[model samples]
Target chain A: MAAIPRLTSRLRIAVTAPATVWLRGAAQSHTWNRLSGGGDRPRHLDLATLARLRLIPLVGFVVAALAVPVTASATTIYAASSLSKVVPSIAPGNTYSFAGSDTLAFQIENGAPADVFLSAAPLYAERLHSKGLCSTPVVFALNTLTFVTPASNPAGITRVQQLDRPGGYRLAVGGKHVPLGIYTRTLLGKLGLGRALTKNTVSSYQKASDVTSVIALGSADAGVVYTTDWYANTTKLLAIPVPASAQPLIRYEACVVMRPGSDTTAANAVIARLSSLAGRQALFNAHFGLPPKT
Target chain B: MTFRTGLFLGGLVVTLVLTFLFLLTPIAALLLQVPPRDLPGLLRDTAVSSALIVSLKTNLIANVLFLSIGTPAAYLIALGRFRGRPVLLTLIELPLVLPPAVAGIALLTAFGAFGLFGSTLAGLGIVLPFTQAAVVVAVTFVAAPFYLRAAISAFAALDRTQLDAARDLGASEAMVFRRIALPLAADALRAGWAMAFARGIGEFGATLLFAGSVARLTETLPLAVYAQLDVNLDSAVAVGLLLLAISGGVLLVAKLPPLWSSAAPSSTAGGW
Candidate 1:
């Protein structure tokens, strides 16, 4: 820790030396006379002087940046993209990074500084748990795949049957490895429309939120997204119902990641909040299903 | 060496070495993740091959377009003495600084389905958002500024007296430009194009947002890395390494002395 300040100061001195030498060269140049002052001394500085002046603030910024301390007490929660809105709202103070569940898991496996891990599916949580990167998974909330179209309904897509035909309309789906995509593909297969709809897919985003955005922006005629995501964007999108029988099991799981130097108590509190009754109410308000009875 | 000179040189070398280590660590880590024997199998994935082909094809066409149009634009701005030239220069360089996400959204609002000219494009039966052309447009929009900025600097650095002497010798303005300006600026222009091409090759956010990440259709190498992340982590790492290699190759080719030295008036000219 003591060496850090010394190292940064050394770096600062090293960077500053060249700029000073270059500035002196510029001040002596003939172009400096023509450009600014015609040999007038005051306000006669060249581009290098101005550049060096700019460097003062930048140097201060780097020093200030190095001086600032990292807040180890603040927890960082790595959650799935589907929980982008709700998780932050529920756990407002801590840092949050939302993406595909698998991507978050991959990041955790590779040593991200995540205090808590919230996955949109059990598979990722289980994988992390098995690897001893996280605690045993606990189901927190549930979601189901549904078709969503832009409010403008560009292709006039209303019924689920419209998606069963290839080239019927431009579709956005999640990537094959992402939980949303896996659930979407499973549901489509259950409905016997996987192959055809796969043909129609124009984009397969790794993040579930991207699917919603594409449809909401009217870039794609429709896309598959979680019921919660559709509910969150009710104004921009209209939803098409999925047959109950065709709905794949969509669960969100949370676990405390075993990262070194993290606030485990704070991490545990976040997981507890998600599994609590208030958490269930928040999830319900956002249209997420409660975990079915054991 | 004098004490002051020695101190300055020591500081400079320290900074240089620090910067090199900072930049090279990530590359070294990326290389370590993928074993050499796994390269062929990773490249064999049809999706990987498709991404490579798409990136190369779109980047090639985009580079050609950049050289043709960007060179002239840079020349005009650097020497035209026209009104609003600063504004034009600023606009050209704007995309270079704009966030990639912002660039993507801007492109969508200008050329998207519901954008200003969306209906006009639709009237022409043209849909661009999910097509390969959209990928090219995204790359062109984000990458053109690199070449343009470099080209402008190259042109601006040329000696004005030589141009005037050519005109005094009864050479046409166009002839002077073709013979004097182009040759003098060739090395810098090549370097700039390499930068733009490299940027285009690595462009992901804008292309994904504008063109949509369709396999083999709109997916570039960076997009392939992203798309394959969880489908196969090894494949993702392999694709990332490929992009790094390609970008490094571009920089290397741009630096090769013999290819650029032919046009130089002095050995040190265009050394950058």
Candidate 2:
């Protein structure tokens, strides 16, 4: 207990070193098995098996290491989609990941360890805050909701009012609980196209990226996704911004998730950098609207 | 023992120990997490019941499809002399090692509404993606290989002399196969079907991606478990336990003797 800090680092070192060696051995044995089919040794194995074996350990290491409660020197910040870019730009040395806002919260709820959570909505962070799982939430970035269609325009959808037109149009949207889904539903109702547009729905997938995939693949006629999602796929998908009057402001919030005896100084520092002037510029450059004035 | 044999035995020991730890521990613990008091309520849980209903129906169809198409393919591989047989076997087994996510996307690319063959299916007014049919397709794609591989092995293991003897006794090839080969391989085929059925029922990633997880629409047991994981873990555990129970039943059914007498012609199913 007294040598806790030292013990944890040593444990990490031990786990990774042997795990890598065993993984390599596993790869060799796999190749040997394939190559020496029906023998004491394998004769040949292709590059594909080698790649798969390499990825298994690497992914296992990441997930295992994160799941370990022992916090090392680095801070693990789980940011939501649009904020993924901030890690490389603002804090290159930290362990950063961008999970869907709902997924990150759910993971944390189920005991995923993270020092900081940068979420797409304050609702989740506030929930965690109320439960004492995280610090008070701070609003950071704002995103606008929009709809998109494949560039091929298979449905010939040209306007917001056209969204409701009867053309056997299939629509894709996020889960009902997620921020994007709530916003998309509100926008549809406000435009009086709620029943018409949502009725021919194929599926309400997990999150924003799923909605993007459905539309991008031309599986659905249109998808309601975040404006940033449209910007990211400018070539593939045509962005149709929601009418400003009906547009709901999506506020992305950040909070430091609690960890016993873990040094949160670095996590706080990372959050501070995100709200900094440079971070603001970086966010805008990446098409995120600045956090609204208090 | 020679040094090399000693090394091999030592490696095997380690392998068995590690495999047991990695595989059994999680399953044992997960099942144990289902409270004893919660056992009776598993059937009463709406989500669990609905998901299980979907799983049983889709998997039954998928396995029937497998037994129809895949059984013959397995028999051909096992008995037929053919060129490029290794290539054919490898092709059949390719999906066995595919990551479920990759399999899901692969199914989508080939069968989605705008997929390569999707437009053709659509022209006939059939939309597979996000439908119950898509779930069956995904299960068939992933589970058929399990059945085929096992069935092939089962067929291949038969004594060829018996086949030849029956043929020499003035039995037609079909007669020889029906009387001699079918009963001999019946147990193996049942085992294979059970494995494939279990795989189909346990499918998650591919089904979620290809069929979409709409509650009571395409949401099978695995999807229901996922949806309920963080929200209502008890219900999730109930569904998982149900799957385990079904899997156990499948194994037991496969292991038991045929319900009818083995000597009867009724026991012989399908062409040799």
Candidate 3:
């Protein structure tokens, strides 16, 4: 019974005793400061006063935002998220500001500036071209999907059909807007395993690059990713060939987005270079696979 | 009115009205777009209900985990001579200012398969990413800071006189905290919890990066919103409405603190 009071005292002191301690410490510091003629100031802002004062600047910012029109002067290149890694290498030291496909379209739709649009699928380029957002779409390279698993192969997945076998193992794929997701669905449908397979899917990321990372990270048992991604990361592991019969040939397409003071000649030079031997070499080097025989 | 006064009023009106519109228009548009006939059907859909259940469960777990650790840490900092306070606070609040994508990447680096302890975890047969558990962890990482920041300020603002009085009366420190300090700070802590809960419910970027948004599995409402936007608009609208309502409700509760429960010095005279 005596021990209980002691325990409670310790607990309470541990929690609430600090307030008094801090206050005493602060008071002592002030006394010492006065005795030594040292001056100090409070650091924290009075938040209530700040709230009222900040409104002035907030209004000013609104006025300024309306008055000033900001635009990038450099030639803008809109690329898919997957290019985040490979684009730097593709156009080493190229003078261009990159944007994501969604933001690019939104900006271009709202009359922002751009020079080139590289889409994961030809559909986006064609859509933009139809709306006069860009030039005609040109297919650049083909990508095939592959299934990647950790070296340990924890899911005991030896065959593609075993994926739908209802265990707790998580399967990762690309999101619906992603090219990989569409292809994965199409291929699964062809194999008559679409809905069943989806039931087991635990993650659908925005890009094939993200899927590769998830799989590589070992959070996912298996992932559907681009051939190039497999090549880039699968140095030790061979891609479980996603049977050619079931594979949907993925394409990367590009078109020059129209801009104010748009340089058709310079833009075409870049486009021509992408199809050029050096560009094709870069694409092949990345293992994006050559464009299928037209 | 004078010319300067009129101009000031006009600017103030513009600022306040524009700010309100900027914040509300998008959410209001979503709320208005909820087709009356489809509202029931959308809510009934497995995708909607499942995602809602998953979001609530995961966010609750995140909130609980945060408070469990955050409250004690706040207590330690608020009392006595706090050492390394700024460094400790910065570490705790890193996720607050971090972009969701960076937060996700950071989580991946620490907990993902190829992460810092990835191999060891793998050897131990433990993988966290792309799981429901991973979603809770991500939300907790992003949401805990809200509660911590609020609690810190609340504890800082507490009156030392009352605490000293309680101690002078021969009350144990535990009794003083239980009867005085805890009640005094309850209102602020409640608001902090609401903020944390709201933030956790709406967490997307980091959760997506760290946990992977899979429908009917790991996907939360935000993920469901993206998924439905990819396939169907009605589903997205319904799920979006649910998120807006929950987020709004949390803010409402935080703002209207006195209505629900009394934080009126209830513990001052109570025997602990």
Candidate 4:
């Protein structure tokens, strides 16, 4: 303990020396300007002014050096909200897992240190691919949007059209930007119930899980969530299917993000696993749709 | 310093340099990752705006509610003689120690739609989960203890003679509380408020599990930040910077002399 302070003082001196030299250069420039009659006298000068100015650059360098390790070691992956149920099941050995397509897409575009990207909807993935975030992504699986209600089924919603019925029964759907909610909206449009459903929609969530929780908890009379989400939440919910004509195909996609010069082996492995039979089985077990050929 | 001391000092300097870089890199990256031209457009996003508004509104309401109910309870606990005071204090502080996720689960188990009161609430046509109200409740549960603990300490620090002096001067119980006790405890109240606000603003797990991250409804800034990261990493950084800016502003406000002065010892000790 006694030696600690002495050591710290020496360390500070060593670290601050370069800054002090830079400051001296700045001071000399000021003096040269004054002697040459370049302009008015320097605004202010103090004994350690050079050290203080140099300190800023030294701190900046130190901060930049420290950040390199964290950026290199971690890979951020953006996934859809529905993946909240699936990712955790597979993420124990993997490097990254984040939910919500919009959130993920936003982060990746903003230059977060992300290596792999998955989205609930093909549109966002395609958008990123078009913008050169990655090569063209492959459709990995499918998702089905369904209505869920509490076990008691208080709203008695038997068909897709009933959701638009003239009643005060609350409905929860994902936000307009969320894939599941977009699909729900598309389905409603196809069924000619869009206007009515929009009027009665009480709340919109960022993730399907939020919608499912509302229905499962009986907060809303009904809510739209993915088929897999309903399966995962069996204890508190019952899934209700929309009519065939109104249902839209929900495709999941994945892409290997192309960093400037980094290796793509890890991303390729993820893609291969997703395409393989074992991966399909895992998806099936999680109640996600198997790719058509599988 | 001896050569050994000098060598140790060198090592310490290197470690600190590395540590400073580790902490500031992400924040620096957040600032640098965005194109200056795109920032305004990103800030205009409806989802981002709504989440920010919801976060601020909910945190404010939760802080007020926590302060109002927690202050008197803390005072009673701190000043009154009770056999189970320690146990009650511990219970009040229990939520503070639990992980936010666990707190969320506990809230769900007790108040979820299928929880103990779920059926009862349902029968009464009341819903608690996945609403703005749930967000407020979750924040309050996690943040109340900070205020309560601080308030208790502030109340305990008061000199009893001051209260006696107020009473002897013919001030009623309510007057004494208003003029003397409360003034003495102002510092604790402000500290408690700052703590509660900070905790409430950053609350995530409980809000996610209990309130549900409904866009434009229950989604807070952190949820917004998380959601952006899911789809667009750049957007996430932008949103994160926005959150960081707000947090920094709040911290500055909390530390300002006007706010800090209220908690200063002399002014809070029932000074004339």
Considering the two chains of model 3, state its CAPRI-style docking category. Answer: acceptable
For each candidate, report what fraction of the true interface contacts it reproduces.
Answer: 0.48, 0.26, 0.62, 0.30
* Cα-lDDT of candidate 2: 0.76
lDDT of each residue in A76-194, candidate 4, tens digit only: 55567677656545543566656677667767776766677888888888888999987788888887777777878877877766766664566777766678778988877887887
Decide which is better by lDDT, 1 or 3.
Answer: 1
lDDT of each: 0.82, 0.76, 0.73, 0.74
Clashing pairs in 3: A12-B173, A12-B174, A13-B173, A18-B80, A217-B113
Restricted to chain B, the TM-score per model reads 0.93, 0.86, 0.89, 0.84
Best candidate per DockQ, number?
Answer: 1
Model 4: iRMSD? 9.9
Off by more than 4 A, model 2 = A1-73, A159-168, A193-198, B1-25, B31-48, B261-272
lDDT of 2 by residue, B96-200 (tens): 999997888888889886689978988998887667898999999999999999989988998788778777767897787667776788888898899888888
Q: Residue B10 error for model 4, in Å?
A: 12
Candidate 4, residues B152-243, lDDT tens digits: the string is 88888889887887788788877766777777787567767787777788788888777766667788887787666545667777787777
Output the lDDT of residue A142, model 2. Answer: 85
**Quick one: best lDDT, which candidate?**
1
RMSD of each: 6.4, 9.3, 11.6, 10.0
- Candidate 1 off by > 4 Å: A1-64, A67-69, A292-294, B258-272
